[model samples]
Target: MIYISDKAKQKVDALRAEGTLASDYFLRVSVVGGGCSGLSYKLDFDNETKPKDQVFEDKGIKVVTDLKSFLYLCNTTLEFSEGINGKGFYFNNPNAARTCACGDSFAV
Candidate 1:
């Protein structure tokens, strides 16, 4: 099961509270190729679900992902940081062997 940190949940809640995102929207996470570290993470607010999509909920947030992405994201935790390093979402992925300097890509 994928997890979400409290900081991440708070950010998601703030986004929804701002009235920009629709009520039915859910967080969709995916892994795509061609990053500096060989794989990149994608995130979006989606209201549609495809066949065979995997669903999970954590910290009052519903997260969806495709089966193919699940293998690379297993036991991953979604996190948010506002430190001097960078301010954005990040993944604490146990399966990742290495991540890039930008923190937007990883290799397993």
Candidate 2:
């Protein structure tokens, strides 16, 4: 199961209100190739639910990911930070053995 932090939910809602995301859309998280750590994380708003997609909900937010990506994201925590580091979404993935300095990529 993927956990969405309170701040992350608020940010997503704010983005929706600002017209950046549609109400029918859900947060899609995936692991793509090509990053410092070999695997990069990606986030997008999607309306289609593929047969292989795994859907989860937290705090009224629906999160979706393909089955292949789910292997690397199980039990991951999605968060948003606007503090000293900067403002952006980040993933705290326990399955990751190592992550890049930017925290956008990881290796298992």
- Per-candidate Cα RMSD to the true structure, in Å, reads 1.0, 1.0
Clashing pairs in 1: none
Q: How far is candidate 2 from the true structure (C-alpha RMSD, Å)?
A: 1.0
Q: Scored by CA lDDT, what does every candidate get?
A: 0.93, 0.95
| lDDT score, candidate 2 | 0.95
Please state the error at residue 38 of candidate 2 in Å.
0.8
lDDT of 2 by residue, 1-108 (tens): 999999999999999999988899999999999899999999998999999899999999999999999999999999999978774999999999999999989999
State the local distance difference test value for candidate 1: 0.93
TM for every model, in the order presented, reads 0.95, 0.95
> Per-residue lDDT of 45-90 in model 1, one digit per residue for the tens?
9999999899999977999999999999989999999878755999
Q: Which ten residues in a row have the lowest lDDT in candidate 2?
A: 79-88
Model 1: how far residue 85 lies from native, Å: 2.7
